[model samples]
Target chain A: MFDFPEFFSFPLGDWINITVDWLTLEWAPFFDVITIAIREPLVSLEHFLWWLPWWAVIVILAAVAWRFAGRRIALFTVCGMLFIGVMGLWDETMTTLAIIVTSVAVSVLVGIPLGILAAKSDRVEAVARPFLDGMQTMPSFVYLIPAVFFFGLGKVPAVVATFIYAVPPCIRLTNLGIRQVSSEVVEAGKAFGSTGLQLLFKIQLPLARPTIMAGVNQTIMMALAMVVIASMIGASGLGLEVLRGIQRLDVGQGFLAGISIVIVAILIDRVSQALGRTRETGLRRGG
Target chain B: MRKVLLALLVGIISISIVLSGCGEAEPEEKPLIKIAELNWGSARFQCEMAKIIIEEGYGYPVELVPGITIPMLQGLRTGDVDVYVEGWLQNQQEAVDTAMEAGDIVMLGFINNDNWQCGFVVPTYVIEGDTERGIEPMVPNLTSVFDLDQPECKELFANPENPSKGLILNGPPGWECEIVTLEQVTTYGLDDHYDVMNTGSSEGLFASLQGAYDKGEPWLGYLWGPTWIAGALDLTLLEEPAYDEEVWNEDHGCAWPSVDLFIAAHKDFPDKAPDVAEMFEKWKLDTPTLNEALAYMLAIEGEPVDVAIWFLKEREEIWTQFVPADVAEKVKAAIAEM
Candidate 1:
């Protein structure tokens, strides 16, 4: 008797019953287990990353780079970070900062170690490669649907969608970084009789830092893109103000909010790019 | 490598076994009933009214979720919303049918009929036929939608914004009016006489109407009742052909029939909250009353919540039957607080 489209007519009367239950019953608990054990502490570090005063953030970023990379790279980092705040987009820039920092933190916690394992074992890399491609290639909106289905709407789903969208780059980079860590370095470590875990920490990862940071810069850009899209699923931020303006035909308000987003994007883009450049220069100086 | 491969295989197998063992158990509490609130003047007010009665009056907490046209229907079919007030029959028939077929929603009775309508509207100037020359004079002979199809009349609306393209400001792109009006324009052969402009937001259309009226310029647009646009503008509906079922098919509901803005509850709603459902059953607001209430909210009070509460208070005698007298007293107290 039911004449509805079969797509909507599943035995689960409530779509959320099947979709949300499937997610919460299976995925949420698993994520909770992993996140509590590893991801939580890493997320806490993101707070420290944002807590630096506006000027100090720039100074500290440049200072760290100067000590590691060189003076030219440090100068670029300082100018980029300062430009973002001076554009009057400081608050929005920080919010975008907090989201990206938190997402990348969780992604790194999940991705880097997986990358290490994938690099070490051909079977692991084979299994991971397809999953990474799916994550990267899937439309960002699809990421939000499952997120809302699983977590309902709000900050949590926003972050979840953002994290899923941001993660692939870090994973791919981590794998490449570890694999590209000079066979000669591995040979040298083995010559010193370095154990597998010790050699990974002291040689492989340390040498791979610059490349991994480049991956992180890409992850931040992806996360920034997701922030605007997440407003559709009820994420509140500058993006919501922009959506609100569009809904009301407040052109001035929408334009201002759009400019705010652009300024934040440019700020983060420059700062992260500078950091990546500096990290490369640091490896050059050390080598 | 072999050992690691074996471990990973074992891990997958173990996870499957564990997952199979851990099947879903229905939650102990009844799910929070989600109510979809569409963004329109009367619909928002009506949803808020229902929320007031359900959550505050009856003491059953309901969550109000905001959604727009297609999304609201999708939400109901998905069971994201257990109740939705103001389901317009003319615009929402296909979605309603689809949801019914899926067993995703149960229809509640019409909240109030004889209120909703849509059509070409024209300023009183057009009806009076006040002509200096180029356009036809007011009051000489215009009475129907067809009369506006005159070339001279079309020339009067010649300005782009004037909708003189025989403009009817349609709802969103995919709305029922968008389809029906397009078909009607073709069927009636007024494509050259008029244009149907799809407004991005209802508010924007109302603002344009208000702007036109203030300037004393002749303005006509597509509109419906129990809407803020109706409350805000003084334009009159241009008469249409009768609502003969044969004339308007599934694809077209001829000339905007007066649809009943309805409140649909979950089938289980009466069982769970009999008192709240009773209030919804009795609650009714017709065109004149809704227009007044909308005017109060958007014009005089400038606060929708305040106007809604005021309406509830003014109509307390009518509502007291569904709610206990003491509870109604509490509702009055709540309104006073607002």
Candidate 2:
């Protein structure tokens, strides 16, 4: 079908598979430790999510949504949570929420610093750009096998899958945010005999906060997207229900799970975006 | 100052990473058979059954490695997984053929017995109206696969998406059944009458069928027996000319031969663990019995271990034959203890 001969094709898939087997052969115990490390946080997060009373969770979410996104979204949150409970998908929804929260938290923790570093150095950005692009674009299926191979098929691999897919935008956006911080502000800080640390914390990061928060929002969305694929492999929750609906041809079931996901996404999105908006307005008033 | 702060943060992150790598003890000294625990009711049930027998009776450890089909098949090929308890012959033929022809994997005993059916299936209500449900028959005269070519068939499934042709869904892409089904569609001269729609996976097919079944709408697509769907739904296999292997190899014009799924393993499995291999060779599950077991599995929220325990407790006559009398006694004792 091609105009050119296919002889020069790179066996990237074969190489990746071979590397996975090789890594497994050499570092099985190391990967096992990592598997446990991943499992511990995931389990704790799930427990914490489950520990909160359903009513308390709803009230807290509504309060947060109202404070940030306004009364309309707050009402939406209450209705959405009620629908999830009514559909008997409370446990599944909570599990999914826990996974998303954990992955998003981890991505931000790792991403922002690397982003700061990339923002500082052109060489680092040059190196990380391709890898970040690859992370974002490379189909999760390509890494899914290795993730399962390393973590042994469950929530751990699911977390790892999300971390890879979702972290890139976090890092990239943080880098962009910091770089876009005005040089005039940096010069003013320096001229005032401010130290590098003080300048970065006081001037750069504050200005970059909105952008970083936007990155966090993107990471959350990506994590939600990746969770569905991960569940198809092993991790369970709303995604598993969706997969069940797909496998069983239960349109009603699929729609139910899908609607639940959309509700969760919208709640998180509106609140987070508003968080950034509020801080920016506050900064303007303070300045 | 910034450099010091960055260095501190880096050090803290590194320490945390190292500290979080906690203890997960490995037991590689006592080598265990790894069973590929595929994510399906019947397959998982079989794996759990085998694990119990191999561990309790044979005194060898066994572990279930959870994964989907393709990776697990690769695991079998590479000996990462030592035992795979279910291999559908036609469905996975395209994937397994290369390894099989090369003798990288070994097929042992028939797991499903010689009892399985597969073809274009439609709900009984699609042909005959459910008077109680107040639904009229949509395609009552549709008996054989070729009857789909009837002009009335298009009127039955007319949708905004496709105005000219009715849709008869096919199997997931890359499945051998999809290939055979498409050939049958062309051969029966129904290609013009119906658009061959590919539902991305088995889930896709089930979803479409389920959506139609719930609404009492017509559906015609490839499906197999001994599944939860087959057990739960009232489906009738559209009539086909009896199976002719010669005709099938040529153009898939005839019916599918009764499928027998075999327990397969890495080629070295037989030589390394002859007893386990032999046990696999003698394994068999009656069709109706397995279907009931599948139903019970779904009833209990799709936990195959619970199904395995129940299967052993109930179907003593079937599993007892898989192992030797002494090993069977051991399994019995373990079961009794549980």
Candidate 3:
């Protein structure tokens, strides 16, 4: 038998434990602030979504679908949402939707600006590229540990984990979108004596609209994907339903909730995609 | 994007096909018994022990399939797994009852009698002042689970997020203990004084306990016996009313019942392989023996399979009691050579 000497052994686990302990003690107030900030909006969104009548929600979704995608998808959205309601999962679906919306909103708010910074500065790009790659490639399950340690347990940790897991694609795409704005267009903006902020808002952003929308689309999908994993840390929704199903070994229940997730994913994916296309078309026609 | 989507779809379909294809017909000469491998140490070790014995002594190929309790029970019902080594009876009573009623599962035998215990626990220091460490007892008079109803006691374990109500750290959501703890809170009329905070997993629950223990903070949570945590930590199991069969079954508050880990098999198992079924029925490990093995694994940080192998080699006398003389000889010889 062979073993590493005491001196040769690294104490990475101990170091992490110490660091986490210290942070929990020293920054308890900061963590409390974060929890309140995230939880208040999340609860309100969940309540609002739950408060709306199922038919009203379906009609609103259908109308939005029709406005962006067309009548066929609108009808599909209505049928799909109605199916979820028929499954007795409408409330859980709404909760999951609220989570996805909040996470994606946060991801976009944080990601787009970081992406813009990365796009502007080569040094920032160099720094952010690997970080984004790491965030994207790291197993989403690994996010739950630090999340639980930091936020105790509940929707806040779930949102934080989802944000970390989902923000990368938004940032990557935003950076790519802005970078892909043609240099000639940028030169034209400069020739017109446009300020940097004016160049971004009036020209670059409009030209990069489709790609940025794609980023939002990816971020939304990624956020939706985190719903089930987040449930493991006490984020309530259809994910918890699925988790309950799995815990009790009820295949019928598990599959029903799982299919509900897929349906929700498809509805959100299609709507976002259609919205992106609608914007692209609007920009193309207006320009 | 179309090409990428098409490629992904094709890859998924082909992989699924290949996976489905891999479950080809077994050779008639040697049958395979699929054993369920659970996440915990004792369960995994017992699974491997069954696997090794069934393979070597009985001349059957054994496959250990890793799974959690619920999915494994489902597998047992669906004939995907032939045997599950340790089934905690009360915790999984609902699932087991439905499966048994449906005639898909059979209880083989008790693996151990009155070996499992679960209840609210707190750091010993909560009750006993640690003079060496210069720490006073947080709740010196706290002994019974009912004592948790006191506002002073609740204040000792006040939840950081919800200071209005003390938090009773329950097991993960969906665990039987989570529901049980919540019911206990309600039944005891402690709902106003305490909130059942469900941790994400056993690990999370223990981490919270350990974190508080490290800081000499008062903490209370649900925990079970024959676990590494209980073995390693100096803690006290809060007392409750003595077990009552009628009261225990019908939503009454009482101490956690002493659980007997049982072996479960597919309903068709005994008819298909009577000898293996007989061996399974006779299989038993007393609490101390099982605890020793679990403690060994925890001490060495050894894998379950390795622990199983060690158990076979070290404790041949105990397992040999379950099998016939010839089979026992064969198993002993196999272990001797290993």
Candidate 4:
């Protein structure tokens, strides 16, 4: 009774491996297609980003920053980009920016639809909640190697790992936002004989926009964190720089790269967070 | 005459635009041949050497794919990586044997079998007491691994998290050295007093040692030479019972066996690039030769390419022997131009 059956064993890992092995065999072509789908845009975007004259990019980013994030943030963005340039990490910074943008974009596209569906249906939320929990809790390292097996170890796996790690907050936050919409307002919409689709598109979505924007911010943060860990699988960027610094025991190099990552993270965070409030503040211009 | 001159100038400018394409020098193919790079310095430096020789002497573009031990070994088996400049034979013996048996990868040549050792090591400052740093020897009487079991020594190096047991920094997880170090501690019956910490990765181990070294702290750990760390820092390798194959196989009670280092290739590599493969077969490096390069890299903080260039520039007699006269001349010409 105390020992609780010494012979009893679970084959959880073995089953997972078997499943992965089967998937690799049966889904090689499918995985390759998905890999290309992720890789093509990422590569082109990276090339385009790096190809732009450095000052041109800095100017564009600063302008965008000014539009939503205010003059202070705009100034900060310029200073950060200049620091990155001065440190001779301009090309690597562009590559990292491309990765982050692509991954966050992917997460948003998939997450919002799922979140809306979950908001409409309690059953879907119940089903997705455990997976979202798992995704958030699962160490990014755990899936990194498997991601390589599926995506063949490069930027594709890095993107896949990053999106998986980052997508959960996007989804859960969206769900919360939609659910938090005032029921009285929803009833008012129903009283006007508005169809369900009309209510969702016009009222519910508009009400949830700020919250969804928060979700996007969270996703970007998570993506940034996972991108650093994804360096182990050959994702070159500031992450690789940091890793090289560690491998060589070069403290200054590691700190420099870590500082660069922090700078990028702060820049992305402040800009996105500010962008979220722009509409509420009546500073949104293009809208 | 003015109209003619203007037309000529315009023609010249148009021709230059057609030729220049904004100075995009027609992309010289970026590394179709993938060479696996593991974490350590000597292996990386050797691969850099091979990459240069292959690119210059053999005219094939090569790239170093950053990978860890097991994954890169797996990559070699699956035909994902084309070459391994320095594959550890002793560390992953079983895995390498299995891969070779399956014909997934083949040993192209020996890389580093120069009777190097890996075991418990301490900074020389720990033993000698660095006068410059105003540090006294923590365990002046301690000399061998056996001395670590003493009460004072154990208390001195006690684990910060669990102070009941002392700490010994082992190699990274999944590393053969980590397993052996763990086993050796148990074999010596020192497990009751000491705990082995497997630093998560090679960088983790290196960083931990660095952190300790910077503070002039006492660190007992597993480390290997022919690395920049070994070259840059003065460390003392603790004594163990001389390596006995029977004892090591039975209980890992003895020191690490100096096994042959090997250069391996994907099974299909010979067919894909036969000349490069032949050149690889001739490519050899000793620990001292690689250590010199690692030291240079440490001093200058140079890239692998820079070190390789240094080697080509300085050690012409060494590399010139590995290739044909024509190939050597070609490489020399390339180096001269570079």
TM-score of chain B of each: 0.79, 0.85, 0.85, 0.89
Off by over 4 Å in 1: A1-287, B1-33, B126-141, B159-168, B250-254
Model 3 native-contact share: 0.25
RMSD to native, candidate 2: 21.9
Which pairs of residues collide in model 4?
A: none
> How many clashes in each candidate?
13, 5, 0, 0
How accurate locally is residue B17 in candidate 2, as Cα lDDT from 0 to 100? 79
TM-score of each: 0.48, 0.53, 0.80, 0.54
Candidates ranked, most accurate by lDDT first: 3, 4, 2, 1
Compare candidates 3 and 4 on lDDT and give the better one. 3
TM-score of 3: 0.80
Per residue, candidate 2 scores C-alpha lDDT tens digits across A125-170 of: 9999999999999988777766655654457778888999999989
The candidate with the higher TM-score, 2 or 4, is: 4
Residue runs of model 3 more than 4 Å from their true location after superposition: A1-37, A40-94, A122-127, A259-267, A274-287, B1-29, B55-59, B94-104, B125-136, B152-163, B172-175, B197-219, B267-276, B313-317, B324-338
- Every model's DockQ: 0.01, 0.02, 0.24, 0.02
Q: What value of lDDT does candidate 2 attain over all alpha carbons?
A: 0.81
Model 3 Cα shift for residue B160 (angstroms): 5.9
